[model samples]
Target: MATINVRRDVKDSFYRYKMPRLLSKVEGKGNGIKTVVPNMTEIARALSRPPSYPTKYFGCELGAQVKCDDKNERYIVNGEHDAERLQTILDGFISKFVLCASCRNPETDIIIKNDDILMDCKACGAQNMADMRHKLSTYIVKNPPAQASKNQRKQRKAATAQTNELGGGFENEEGGSDDDIISQRINKEAAGLSMESKLAQEDWSEDTSEAAVAQRMRELSVKGVAAFAEDDDEGGESKYELFGAWLDEQDNNTISDDDIIAKAEELDVYGKYKACQVLVQCIFDESIAAQIPKRANLLRKFVTEEKHQKAALGGLERLVGLEYKDALMKKVPGILMKLYDVEIIEDDVFIKWGEKPSKKYVAKDVSKAVKKAAQPFLEWIENASEEEDSD
Candidate 1:
């Protein structure tokens, strides 16, 4: 009945996400021996994934047959695998399937679109593609999760309720009359709250409107993120272009990170997220993998948020995928490893980047080529993460 962190890579004792420890028992003898997982249902419940997924994953990884007797609530894998080894394999399943590629949160729903498998994260709103090259992906596509239907029903119910609220009516989508008395009672209770109490419950400081965000940006004044502000007004685009021009003029051999910061501040684009993209594209060339360690501190300074990390990745995509495709494309994996080693980019960010191609920085085909070249490093990152968890 022991529990372990759902994300084995996360060693925090107080981690909120957890799953029941995998329990394996070997049954039969000789060629008839098989490993039975008595608690797989419980484990899958905790992970919000179908129990069949991990079972099939075990089969695929170990090159053994897996059997599931759902009515009897039993799952088994061929061969006499021990609990310790099975646990390590389970960690790999969790990393590839359950955890979000962007936030590493275990709260995700499996979504299949066309030939692609995607993990839609509830924590960070990032939709990450699963590694379809894995043998389990084909199985997952053939047998979608049962919860998908329930999720669709929930969405429909929420939509109907929202329509009722906005239209000031108690009727549902099917033209059926809702409970008039209950609706009146709910309205009466809502009307009973004092305006002062409502005002007290509201937190004005957390305003995320455009005006508020613009005001904050103005007050902060080009620390290093102004170039990547969410605003895309003509003035903002002009400032970004000017910053890019200035960055193109700097010599990578002589210009220090401090000098870059000073110029960014002078140009009033220091704190913008897009500034990271421009800097990365202009600062590094074919020798980017080798130069990353030397300029890792500068990257750390700019990549303060997820969006900034995304911009930096976009820059790399442009550099390797577009500008120097022949020279640097083959080295994409090593380049990414260097970025990871120096902490210039995080595992989640790069993993998400490698899962799919984006055309925001480079051509769609070029973006795909870049990600294709990075597959080896991406697999290494996932494998290394699982191995770390085993320790």
Candidate 2:
């Protein structure tokens, strides 16, 4: 299937994170004309969003009624709409709900918390408020995400179990039911309890002392950077899986240089070029252009040899080219310049990465876009080197 970038505003032909080009089929005569989106499910999966969102959004934007039949996998907007018009409307939906407000990355989860909608970015770990003014917010609130729906089912099941237990057919010695016996017992106990005893039962004071905190940390078994216990006893996890798990446990915005280094060392993957690749992808976010300079010393520890530099570049390729393509593709040159200035990455590294697009790190198209974005910076490096030789 032909695909285009999710963010239609991105003009880069090689941009990653693409969804199927919207296909609309208009059916029926003039008065009863309706547009059907046959591939809404595929598009929604690519956007990491629900298909109903875009379908309903089309109705809201065009002031037309929309029908979303999930079981049948059919989405219809009431009108004779063309593909171009629907695609343009989809772009608006992506901007307002799909992309993270802070980092502009589309890897976000739409959550309804306390009747308000929020977009939680997997890349930046920022919880941004979604536009509540939009009419779709009401629909989203009424029908929360699948995770929330599952939680609700669990709650209902628990409640049913409790009801079954209390309303069971067990008869007491006095011929009363479990519910009646339990109610009478509760009333008797409440009459007998003193105010001081009730107060003791209601004690909610937490143990916040230093010793208590130390005990909690010990129980967590903090061994360097591993959040939970190692899977060595489980006996199937590879070293790379272990490293990946540790990285997954970390919060991108707050992970410090010391923790990254300590964890890498503890895992005995400190000097491995592959480790550098994993580190760069997991630690950096859309703010990577600014973060590169700040973490120059840390990056230097990993990006020493040309091979390590290449691995680091691969990480960046996946991060910017694929993860945050729309937001970071244009900033590739400045990011490369920052790395060069900080001495973490050399001129040769840029030249080598820009020589050709490789599918080693990201999709071929995405790699091409990133390399293409670095052209201006690569040219400047060559010009500077020529001037130095002349001097």
Model 2 segments more than 4 A misplaced: 1-237
Cα error, residue 280 of model 1, in Å, equals: 0.7
Provide the lDDT at 75 for model 2.
86
Q: Relative to the unseen true structure, what is the Cα RMSD of model 1? A: 19.6
Global lDDT of each model? 0.77, 0.75
TM-score of 2: 0.40
The lDDT of model 2 is: 0.75
lDDT of 1 by residue, 17-110 (tens): 6798888756544465677786788899888888999999999999999998775456889998988899999989988998888766676789
Worst 10 residues of 1 by lDDT: 168-177
The window of 10 residues in a row where model 2 has the poorest summed lDDT is 228-237
316-336: candidate 2 lDDT, tens digit per residue? 898897788898989988988
Q: Compute the lDDT for candidate 1.
A: 0.77
